[model samples]
Target: MNTATTLPRGPGRNGAPRRGAAWLMLAGALLLSACTTPLDPRKDASLQQAAYTTDRPVVRPTRSVSSFSDSLMCMDHMLRAAQVPTTLITSKQVIDYSSRVPVAAKDMIITSLSQMSRLSNAFRYVDYEVDIVRQDTVQNLTTILLNNNLMQLQRPALYVSGAIAFVDQNVVTNRFDAGTSASRLDTGYSRNRSATVIGLEMHLGDFRTRTLIPGLDSANEVVIGSGSQGLDVAGRIGSYGVNFNVGRDYALGAGGAMRTLIDLATIELVGKWARVPYWQCLTLEQTHPDFQRQMRDWFDESGGVGQATLVQNSLIAQGYLQAGTDLLALDSPALRTALTQFQIDSLLVPTGVLDFSTYERAMRHFVTLAPDGSLQRVGWGPSGPTGSMAENKGDSTPVRTSGLVLTSTTPPPRRIDMQIENALPPGMEPTFEVGEQVFVSATVSRTSHMYCYFADPSGNVMRLTPNQVTPHSLVAANQALRLPDWLVPNPAFIMDASRPGTERVACFAAETDVLPRLPAPLQGAGLVNIPGYRTIEDIDKAFQQGVGTSGYVKSEVYWKTQPKKAQPAAAAPAAPQPAKR
Candidate 1:
């Protein structure tokens, strides 16, 4: 359950704070004196919020004035940028809520990570566990729900998240440097417990999601982290949905002989770190002085990380090459030489001094190769075409899917009080039937209306039964279909599209979706509403029947394709027409 070792810093937002941490020292003393039992998965448990328990049930706000707030705030901003929806816990009620529960402890870490996932609408959930090492130092766990490690892995990534550890010699067992700069460095000798956890990191998965078999998620990741000196972090995951890779390396404080134990841990994590270039792919010490710089270079050369890098490079370079000066240095006489050397193509006359243009070129390639772009299909082209052939040159992406929603060219129908009735002149009774489309501009309320009609062109009218198409979620958005042009005046009202005949499409219901729902707003020419009206006892009474369509058109209407774009140039987008309101 524990993999204690040292890992080098991967990325930094900023350092932790000072005064704000006083509470930790205060809490540390309290922790030493408190009667609370050491947290044991078997003892302390988390309260269930839904189906799972959390890590820290009770999170008492830091009592001492502190600076960690800034770190927390920065983290919040970073997560948001990642497109993760984070809900800051706003409770002022502080209570020690954690108890000894297995799920609760695990939920602490797993849950936090999972929240990251939910922010992005990614994976569904997280499951975690906790094991206590030093009892008197800290109490219960802090549950962190993790995002779907699986999903991120499928997409491939280079992630860095964790806690830090501080070791100050001047501090004795209880007198720690938790709230001061002194904590960052140690002021004493060996044999004494000189290090404490500063912050911890998270797990990263490579193409695990894309290549992993079926059932696995986080289990595929290899966790790596160390505290002030080094903290424990160990988890072996090899479930479904992933391909496995093996790697290891370690060097702490300028090659000062780090333990194999530390070496093993880093190897595990960076093996998973991945997405870094060939230079970073080498062992740590091999590129020690400038590992991170090397990594940046690799990331730049790799065309960003994920399922579509090379394809993206070719697209950005489309037609820009005179010789080797292609938009992306992806082609020509020079880059190929670098590729052969199994090294990143540096930017230089011949030395690879990659400049701003290189990065811009890489960015362009990465952007164009976005998952939904034309390059997605280039994989289907003849095996490995030459650099001269631009991939998207033969682009065949769909202009729009079968249900692609388009903006309206006209206004929509109107809402009418179908419950309202119109009074007729004496001896002039009217009946509506098939053949005449009720060219309406408004829809009526969602309910049953007394559909009354007269026999012949002048007789007593009778109310007819309604076909099933009541209260529906239609009309909420882009829902609108038209009535068949067959409805005529009849004592017995009939619905054409609702029947079975040459025109009896079928007994169906259409609420006006774009084949499927369009992901846009629906509007039209100045906006119109076609509302149906039902007669009541009097014309005035029917007028007060309310608005909205009382019935739904029953049939299947479809949209035809646009004229294919003429070749030789990108077609200009069509101007939007007002929707038929």
Candidate 2:
């Protein structure tokens, strides 16, 4: 009877054993959930990650003004003293190696020399091209032969020749890797360094004597640094992982390198030939004692106010003046007004007088000459924020006037026309009829990158400069470029009978190509209409309505078109020939 009663009691509700089993099941479910969820114990902890980095450095050649300024000044003085007409004939091949340079580089050297000649009156230069010279020669010869008159050609006393040589070498290499075993991140860093040594040589030869000018052979070397960088990153957490790498290299084009080399070479050669007194301006204590004394006296007397005119000119040269304003007049109401405005803009004390503080502030806007004679521009240091003249107003440094007035004379030396010719049928007056081909010949007064376009009678504008034919925008000085190489009004486009009127062929010239900024809707049925221009005159008016300081020249030609001719009456039945009777 006792054993039967014990068995029945096993089925009792809310027993201790049943409650313990339910609690055990709940605990097991919680353990399983914890095991399946992602866990990060370092979620809010600051831990280092793996990193990899690489760098390539490109070093550019720098100009040594002190080393060459003396020679340049000497040459300038000598050329002025001699008063001889000179012609500089630079070798087309400036580099001795086989590297190719841009044609613009050669032209740039010539342009630089020509500009120097104009500014210093060092020598009378012949700025004409070979063709122009030949044409002039022919005309002179004809006049001389027909009139029995004598003509003379100015010859050069010395012919300058220069060549550049270069050597590139890797100088240094570095690599680094760092990481902790407990972290899932790692990083690596690497750097490669290289140097380029450029050698410049120049010699002066006498064409008449067929000998080298004594003391005119010169050579110099410039060193430039170049390199590259790379970065690598890799990490993993259990099955999850990520890897990434990137790299870049640095280098300069042959054209740019050659340009820098040529400029330095020309400057040095000119200096040597002229025998510029290298110590005249540099050895201020020796040659200009009295001048230095006067500068000191002036600084004390006027506190930099005496040189207001110089400061104003410097401001104008630096483009601080608003458009169409006259140069500031010294000691006048106009000058005071301008100075006050400039001070306000530059965050100065707003004093209208050209005090020492004002002079010092203005000088910071320009290039300065270093003690070693190198030209240094503000904010161009290797390890500092570079500043530009455009940022002069934002500079907050207090003006320092210690030696400002003494350097008034040494104010940093700072330093487009276009023509369009219409090619029409012989004896035509730049006018073309329907179905007749219209060709345009364009030339610029200076070397520039240009953009050419045409607005047709249908009010559609088409790009002509960067077209399929001549795909480059570099237009050399005085060089002729023909538009639409093969006669316009052909298959792609023809004179529209319904919209017969004047079509304009316009060309814009600038030191650099600015075609990308041209208004859009570049290609459509009525682009001119979108601009609200109905006629060529309206387009021209709109085109001229831009800031005049853009350094761009616009020239256009107008051509008219009429209805196509009727098939010519079928030759009028062979004119009945009267048959060559």
Candidate 3:
């Protein structure tokens, strides 16, 4: 065992103990002072990875989207179907009282409209008063300088105005608490949740008349809920105590809710104004009451001709009717037969009539169906082909006129017909053997410029007309023109069935020459293959862009080919032995 001995309280010789204490105090003071200035890593610590560093990589940015993003795209197609004209529009900064919401309402509206007009620009936004103060300053400068060319503002046709009408906080609240206590320990847990309501309103106004359009307003709201929970336990014995606590919090973002509300309102306003079937984008089926109302509204707006066109287009896409059939010809036997067949297939009464019910059924599917059923919003333009519009000049053929003069009041009817040159039974789609020679016959409703293309089985489209042999693209009304015209001697233009699949012949007729405006492949000389036109849908889209929906009429005919059946070699004459026998 060791015994402890105590030292005297008095100082040692020369006050050595006190001096030692003083040295310690001085050293501590120096250390404390050193902390005021950061120590250089080179002097104090090795330069390794920082203690606060993490292994996570930086996150890449992606496009921001809300729940209604796809709905906005679907709305774009609706506007295209209606052929809504592009109009200039602008919006004032949306008013908001909730500071938690994003302050980019104007930008959100512009973005939504842009997405809705991707196929056809239905709205062109003009930044006129984005910054009122800057706008005023520029206006003053322009006025004072007396420079007429200093600024030019495009007058907008419409203005969109809106506000975050209300943000009701803590509209609903709930809490739950539970706990168990033991002899010397206690534990408890608590959960609480609260909901808030956000409302937004938007209105469309006629900028020219300085008046808000009646019935073109939207008011929508969203509910955001937040919840959090916590748990804790404590134990104490004598003078000691122990405690633990954990919490969880979850809530919908107010900013995202506000954006969603804005998007919904934009869809409502534009859809109502354009008179389209907007409910389709909202995931509502055609049987829904809202959809029926909207559909009826559209039906009333689009008259008989428009309804017929819609049905015809749908039928063409479904392969029930030939492409490029006259949209206005309701009494045609071919159209009636197609309608009857479509009705039978759809399990409806085969009336062969374009009644309201038939049109409604057709129109509903038209928005959702594409040729391959993979419709997407894509940008298309003329793929450059080497040639000039002048090259489309027709050859010196005797002109035939019906002594009919076209006037503004009597616009030429857009109609075209296509058929195999010598199809059996005269009106049916024909089939040919592989390597069989084929010719296409075309006719127009009036004296018009025509361009024709043949899409082979391999999806390669070749321009069959306006070739060097038969340079005449202009055809007299009601005159049948055969490809590789029999009139031309030693015609180089030839179309021999090559593959064992279906091929299509498409012809377009327009009162004014639209050949130059078409894709480059369609405007080339000789039998050149049209690139990128892989399907009849692709071909139709190209013509729709070049000649527009109303500027020209188109017709299509299909023919199928198969491998020629090998004729069994005539049985060899029975051996001479058989004759001898």
Candidate 4:
């Protein structure tokens, strides 16, 4: 046995590494793994917002230009005439004399005009995408029958055409340099600038007549600019040299500039077509005081027995004259006295003669006799029906005797509550997928005549109620009418691929049947082939001009086609087993 040498250990130290240290190392690693890298504010923020901070409030850049919607609305208000059915065709080259024009410029104009049609109710746009096959002059019925592709197309009344051009362009550049001898450093800078001008011309014409509308031609110009600057520095000390450069790129390119010009031109073109007030919807020549005076004089001199009879009937309708007012007694003192009194009440000169102003005012109050012989308020138009009792041969009553009796008539005010619900399996959202069945239910608060219609993604209106099954337009008070019934899970409409956007349902109810007058197809089959009833404003305006008081409600639902799922890939064959096992 030999004596073993014992080594002296350091104070408060372990001979072997501490086990706790290993755990400490592991914990440190976990802490580091949990921590995330800090994000740079400059890189994370959007370019539009990065320039602003807490002290520097964001100031949006301003431009003295009109937007597409603004121009469309302006045109709509100015063009108060009935909507015209129109077709827009683009030429092969939308922009002429310009190399920087986008290939899609023609498509852009077409799409913008289509959108304008929807928003303004100014035009009913018909799809121009149709296939036509020329036939021989001596074609027989067999040939026609064999070519089933034949279609009966509706002709448009108006056509719009236009072109764009690049007028001029220029560019400039400047450079400068500075150096300091003591620091042995040099700095240089250069600035480049460019500008372009573009022009547009548009024309509108009557498609059938092939004649340009008097004041529908327009021209506009737009200018765009861009600039950039660069700086460079170099220094050398004891055979060692260093160089650096900094530069700023041009913010806008030629393509972007051309697009801006095209948009501005479109706004100008719409303004001209619509004859907007400040933007020149109507030209000075058309609205000159001298021309208007001449027109008034012509109309005044052209009055005849027809005009006198119209004035007499309108006065009777407005309750200014009692029944038995003689239409043939235009020169009667009683008629002249009544006309003078009406003129005074209307804040016009007390002219005993029925002048144009008095005639116009009286016409505004003209009343219509319903089929049941009840007097109803109706708007005056060129095609408005006449109310003369003589027109009704079966009725023996004279027009003067059949005048509406003046009485206090007031409609009771009532509120109508409408509710729309989706009848599908409860899920995250009440959205429908294309090809899936959609069930919708509607209810009203009171027993009334309800007219329900839906506007699809393409602005088509379809009548939902009063269909084959639910023939009656009236709904029971507080009763739910489940659409398509229980047997039909999906209504007459299906969520097709083309209709993959928000669909709106509008319902109007009244104690009396107050549905707006619809086209023949809509009233019978409840299908809207034309782009009608897209805006609620149109529906509301119709109700206001209708015979009775009513209330309305609207609801919207989203429809979309579900994205296809990706299939899983097959697993790779297991690695070959080693040789010989």
Candidate 5:
């Protein structure tokens, strides 16, 4: 473990405060300093896989203007990174649910429509021009928008909501827990399900006024049943249901409760609203109070999340936005004013009003939300696409690309290797005599040596050896470090042991136990250097010298550079050109 100093003690018997303090500390240290054996993850196999914890704040906030952009950006990012459901509004993906399935499918369609409308103008997309007929057993759905007027807006969105209810209990389908699997634990009373959004859709822009929405936003949720109607129930096609044990065989499934199903469907609708805001949807009318605010947030403020104050400060810094009482006040002239304000470069803040320069600037910063849903602010400048503010400009510090190639293909209990390019704290010692091991543990994630010496919050700097607190110029308080609890039993915590003399490099992983303390596995010298092989020395060298990249240059440019000059070298520069001089 890293060496630590004990502070002087309080006076005791002979009024020798320092001596008493040292002795007391010595006793305490002696009692706790013994080397412990490593822990193991195998101790508990169930504690695997990461789950979303409640520590993070929830939802898109309407109070803050930038909150809109932040939510959009995060959603955009998550969509690109994962298989997000219902990514964006389109026709094929969001058809009327009732038309696609049985009459029971209306709830999902209506719910999705309502949610889309709240999030955009398509609040009633599903309800638009929909004709449900008990006689035909089919619903006719038509496009709600008139000649794509809404698609032309700066920010546009669509919402759809659907529902269903079966009064006379009948057989629907063998609904499983997830609807994809089967189990003997089936509901024996009435097997029915009213799934809605199994169909629901949207197009860009407005679709109100006209019979665009087939139904209404206030739609009912479709319910599916768990239990079956007993007594050898038979339909026109086949026989179903149990002959006996009605009550004992069927418990009230979550889907079985009509009230519960409706409430759940409502929650799904509301949850969509809580995630994607309407302003970005561009569905509301011109008179809506949020029209301007919505546009500003989506285009002016940097789209980011979990960092609201940061966004507010950014808008204020540009003098485009400010908080006034409860309402956000925007400087209508910000777009115009900022055009000349930056001889440098920045995204064009979308001032509600557009001018020649405003449009010019906007085009420069037209960050199209890519189909994948990830976004990058491109300066549609004369030179064309440039790097996004989020682009890695290749700082002097080393940046390794690794980890979280997470996928359904790989089940839980996965292990990943993480290496921090820079982990040292500031005021790192110039020289030190190594006589012991430097312990590495999950706690390293919290330890900040740089904070101890320097007065900044940029995390660690000039750190030497992680773990173990020391009697240095600075220290941290409230070091309530949290690590994935399951890994605690593993060597996730450590107290290093050092030889008489040698430097130790410690790498830490979350929720992992220590390696078996086998004698130095290699028989040769303590340090063996490999040339091509990447080792600790190599990593440290790479980190120090900034390897992996020669710094950022376009890959295509370098690709052609390797080829010989295509234009034939000017015929030896025409030796006869001397006459012109």
Candidate 6:
């Protein structure tokens, strides 16, 4: 060290100064490398924003297309009737300057189509991914994949094309600012409010002809709002300055608005194309001004023959007329009989004719919203025991009269939705083949005691649940209970369609355990009829009388049975050949 310090004072042939210089250069290199090296967690690298990150816990993503999920499901029957191939090829682009909206309008339409087709597979989507090749050469993913013998593609019959039409921002705006100053203090406040309108439009086209279908286009709009408020204070006194500011801003998410618009547009386009009563999905009653106006237009467009078709379809949907009957045969005995019965039940004049009054009444109460968010037929007159609209407007509890003769006397505040695979929606009277294994999926609006019954084509009714296999009758709210416990070795009752003809599955639910109140025939866990009740109506009467003015709801789904197709006998196993010894 003594020699190095002395030699560094001057440049000379001595190696001491050169060695010192080299050491300094090496030290600087080491420092620079340390600065550039990435931190290692093994060496205890510190975390940034870790505490704040957990302050607001992360949440799972939620579905946005739920407002009309029930309505979409209700339309499955109609869509299956059409059974057409539909495709969506909308551009993922925003037509207006509002870039904040997600480019997922096309996806929403596809989802809606899927929901409506869950049961019957109403529409098929063409997954024709596009591939832009050289100029004048464009190929779809289907063609490219098939060239390699990878997969098959389904040809599309109809295609949906459109865009996120527009987002009109700041359609309405208001702003206010106020400030006051006194002495060495100053204060101010401000607020800004604005509204926006988002719209989406889609058109249906014949994929084969490449022509847009007229009157099948849909354009829908939704409004969203945003606002902000702020306060500011500033002052100076005695050579000191002070300032304070506070702000709060709030806005509705645009994603929800866009999704709602897309759902509405999808319902409109598909409903128009399929010619179903689509307005039911939108929860619009016939009394609505807009509904009435639309009905007028449809009425004019659909003259006498069209009106008859509409009425016939309505009757079939309500279980009054058999499906596949001639719609143009308005004067048929079957039509008149069904119409007269419907009129008598609805408290209307039994005209036995398809008149405008009958049409209006039938359309008005085709479907109503159940408290459980499913769609069910009104099943009674507006002034029935369920009370008037005014009475139910403020009541949350479900009210209704029940019987085999009269299923629902008024709309209920709560309801249970029962579904069978490949079957029509409840109240549509779907059919089942004899010997078919039947499984029931019953979903309730709230946790309640549920009872399931099977009324054969004849007058016999058997209790299906609260049996030994699934003795517990309490079902959780919004939970689906599958009947005939497949998990158990011996389910209480096997729902084999041994009997043929029109049959019904009636499910009764209530806040309390109404099983004890039911007639002896329906109380226990067995396929055997209850001991006390002589008929199914007795059980219904017991419920109406015992659980009076309480939370009680019933869902009855009718299904017809036909002989199962005879299966060919398997070829007898060939006799084993005797080996030559």
**Highest-lDDT candidate:** 3
Model 2, position 225, has a per-residue lDDT of: 58
TM-score of each: 0.17, 0.36, 0.45, 0.36, 0.17, 0.44
Q: What would the TM-score be for candidate 3 when compared with the true structure?
A: 0.45
Instruction: Rate residue 17 of model 1 by lDDT.
Output: 40
Which parts of model 3 are misplaced by more than 4 Å? 1-31, 36-38, 41-57, 133-148, 178-183, 236-241, 284-581
lDDT of 5 by residue, 1-581 (tens): 89999866545534687678899999888767653545577775555533234445664222212112223322332322222222232221222223323323344334333332321222223223333433232222122233444322212244343333223333344543312212323332333333222212222322242233332233433333344333222223234433233322333332223333333333334334444332332211221333344434444443222122232223233333332312223343543343323211222333343333232222322333333343323322222223332233332332221121111122123121121111234344312222221322111221122110000111211222222332231112111122111114453233222222223233322221211221222111222232232233333333334322321111000000122225655555545646655
Mark the regions of model 5 whose C-alpha exceeds 4 Å error after superposition: 1-220, 224-252, 255-581
Error of 2 at 446 (Å): 24
Top candidate when judged by TM-score against the true structure: 3
The digit string of per-residue lDDT tens for model 4 on 15-130 reads 34565688789999988876765656677567647456655745432222222333443343343222222333332235465665444655555555644543223444444532
Model 1 TM: 0.17
- Between 3 and 6, whose TM-score is larger? 3
Question: Every model's Cα RMSD, please?
Answer: 30.3, 22.7, 28.5, 30.1, 36.9, 20.3
- The 10-residue segment of model 6 with minimum total lDDT is 400-409
- What root-mean-square deviation over C-alphas does model 5 reach? 36.9
Please list the residue runs of candidate 1 whose C-alpha ends up more than 4 Å from where it truly belongs after superposition: 1-295, 298-581
Backbone collisions counted per model: 134, 31, 1, 2, 76, 7
The per-residue C-alpha lDDT of model 6 at residue 322 equals 58
- Compared with the true structure, what per-residue lDDT tens digits does model 3 show for residues 1-581? 99999876666565887799899999999999999978677754443555445455554332445657657877866775565766789998898877657668888899899888654456878865645454687557755554567566779999999998988999999999999999789999999999999899999999999899999999998899999999999998988988989998998887767767777888899989888989778652332223445556656666776667556756665555554556547888999987876665443577888876566555554222122332211111022111221112342322222222211124335577665544254344688889888876676655678877788788887777777766777776545567655435577677778899998888877766787887886677758776767766686787799879888788988888989989889877865655554
lDDT of 2 by residue, 1-581 (tens): 45544544455665877888999999999999999998885773443232122233343222222222333443433443343233434333344552433335446556446534531344433332334344587665655664674544445555656566444444334444443343787666566666666566667677577677787766765555566677777899798998788777776444445554555566656666665543333432212213323333433543333455445644553333433445455667877866765565444577687765455445443434344443333432222223332124455543322232321323222112222223234455455547575555565644567766667777665556654444577765434455543223343332222336777767767655554444443322321234544444443443444323345667776666676767756444544546565
Error of 6 at 414 (Å): 15
